[model samples]
Target: MERYVDGFVLPVPTEKIDAYREMAAEAGKLWIEHGALEYFEGVGDDMESDMDGMPVRTFPEIAESSDDESAVFAFIVFESREHRDEVNAKVMDDPAMDPERPSEEMPFESGRMAYGGFRSLVSYEK
Candidate 1:
C-alpha cells in the first residue's frame, strides 16, 4: 500500500541538541499515539558530502545551517493521505502537543523550519 509522509527540516543550535532530543522523543510518542505509522527524527552527522560534481546541495546547505547549528530532519509516516490528515488533526488538537503551552524554551528556531507533505511514490520493504 502507498504511504503518506510529512517531512521537516530544522536548523537547530548545536548546544541545544540534548534538549531537542528530549522534545522530539515526546513529540514522537504523541504522533504514534495519534496513529502515525512511524515517527523518525535524525540529527545530521554525515551531512558533509564530498562527492565530485554533485548536482544538488547537501542537507546543511539546504537548511542554511551555520557553524553553531545542526540540521534536524524528521518525518512522520501514515498509511495513506487521508489517514495522515485525520491523524494530524488529532495530534494538533491534543494539548500536550501544543507549542504555546507553558514549557521549556524551544531548542530550534521555528522561523527557519521547512516542512511539506509528500506522496510516497515508491516504497519497498523486505
Candidate 2:
C-alpha cells in the first residue's frame, strides 16, 4: 500500500544529541498516539565518507551543519496523504505539542530545519 511521509532534516549541536534524542522520543510518542504509523529519528553516523563520488548533496551539506553540529534526519509515516494531514492537525492541537506552551527548549535551531511532505511512489514490505 502507498504511504505518506513527513520528513525533516536539521542540525543539532553535537553535545546536545542526547538531549535532542530525549525530546524526539517524547514527540514520537505523541505522534504515535495521534495515529502516526511509524516515527523514526536518526543522527548522522557515516555521513562524511559515504558520499565518496556521489554528485548529490549530503545531509550535513543540506543542513549547513557546522563541525560542532550533527545532522539529524527524521520521518513520520502515515497511511495516506489525507491521513497524514488529519493526524498532524490533531497532534498540533494537542496542548502538550503546542509551541506556545512552556516546554523544554529545542536543542536545535528551528529556522534552519528543512521539512516536507511526500507521497510514496514505491513501497514494499516482507
Candidate 3:
C-alpha cells in the first residue's frame, strides 16, 4: 500500500549527539504509540561527497551547519496522509511533545529544521 512520510533535515551539534539520540528515542516511542508505522532518525556519518566530481551541495551545506554540527535526517511512516494526520494530532496533544517548550532548550536549532509531508510515489519491500 502507498504510505505517507514526514521527513526532516536539520543540524545537530556533534557534542550533543547522545542527548539528541535520547530525545529522538523518546519521541519515536510517542509516535509509535500514537500509531506511526515506523520512526527513524539518523545522524550524518559519511555525508561529505563530491558526487564523482560533479558539483553538489552536501547535507551540511544544505542544512547550513558548521563543522561542529552533524546533519540529521529523520522520518516517520504512516498508512496514509489521513493516518499521519490522526497520529500526529494525538502525538501533538501528548505532553511529551512539550508544545509550549522553549526552542532554546531543544537539542538542535528548531528554526533551521526543514520539514515536509510526502505521499509515496513508489514503494517496495522485501
Candidate 4:
C-alpha cells in the first residue's frame, strides 16, 4: 500500500498563485529526489451539490468570500508510511524546506499553511 503526503492549501489571495506554484515546483523536485514516487498539484474547482446535499467532487471546494481567490491541492506518493516519513525528515533537513525563505511570495501568511499525511485505504483504477 502506498502512503501519501496530502496538502490542502488555501491561498491568502489570488496574487499568491505565482509564488505558490514556484514553491510547489521546488518542493516537488526535493520530494522526488528524496525517493517520492510521484508529486502532483492542482487548482481547486467549484462543484455542484448532489441530491443528498453533498458536494460531488474528489477534492474540496474553495471557500467563497475568501481573501484568497484560489486553493492549491498537492500530494506526494511513497511506497509506505515509513518511507514517506523518512523522505519527509530528509526534506525538512535539506535546507530547501525553509518556510522563511520561500522560493516565491507565498499566497497566504506562512502561519496559515495547512497540511497532513494519509495512507491508501481503497483505490480504484482503470
| Candidate closest to the true structure, highest lDDT | 3
lDDT of 4 by residue, 13-116 (tens): 66767776787789889999989888998776643456587645433343332534665666788878889889888999998777686535555565545677
Off by over 4 Å in 4: 47-68, 99-105
Q: Model 3, which residues run further than 4 Å from truth? A: none
Highest TM-score: which candidate?
3
**Alpha-carbon deviation at 93 in model 2, angstroms:** 1.3
Ranking by TM-score: 3, 1, 2, 4
For model 4 the local lDDT of residue 49 reads 54
lDDT tens readout by residue for model 3, 1-126: 999999999999999899899999999999999999999999998886858889988788889889899999999999999999999999989988876877777899888999999999999988
Worst 10 residues of 4 by lDDT: 58-67
Please write out the lDDT profile of model 2 over residues 1-126, one tens digit for every residue: 999999999999999999899999999999999999999999999886456676878899998999999999999999999999999999999988757744447788888999999999889988
Query: Cα RMSD (Å) per model?
Result: 1.6, 1.8, 1.2, 3.5
> For residues 54-81, what per-residue lDDT tens digits would candidate 1 score against the true structure?
7768788888999999999999999999
Winner on lDDT (2 vs 3): 3
Q: After superposition, how far is residue 13 of candidate 4 from its true place, in Å?
A: 1.5
Report lDDT per candidate.
0.91, 0.92, 0.93, 0.68
Candidate 2, clashing residue pairs?
none
Candidate 1 achieves a global lDDT of 0.91
**1 or 2, which is superior by lDDT?**
2
Clashing pairs in 3: none
Q: Candidate 4 overall Cα lDDT vs. reference?
A: 0.68
**TM, every model:** 0.92, 0.92, 0.94, 0.73
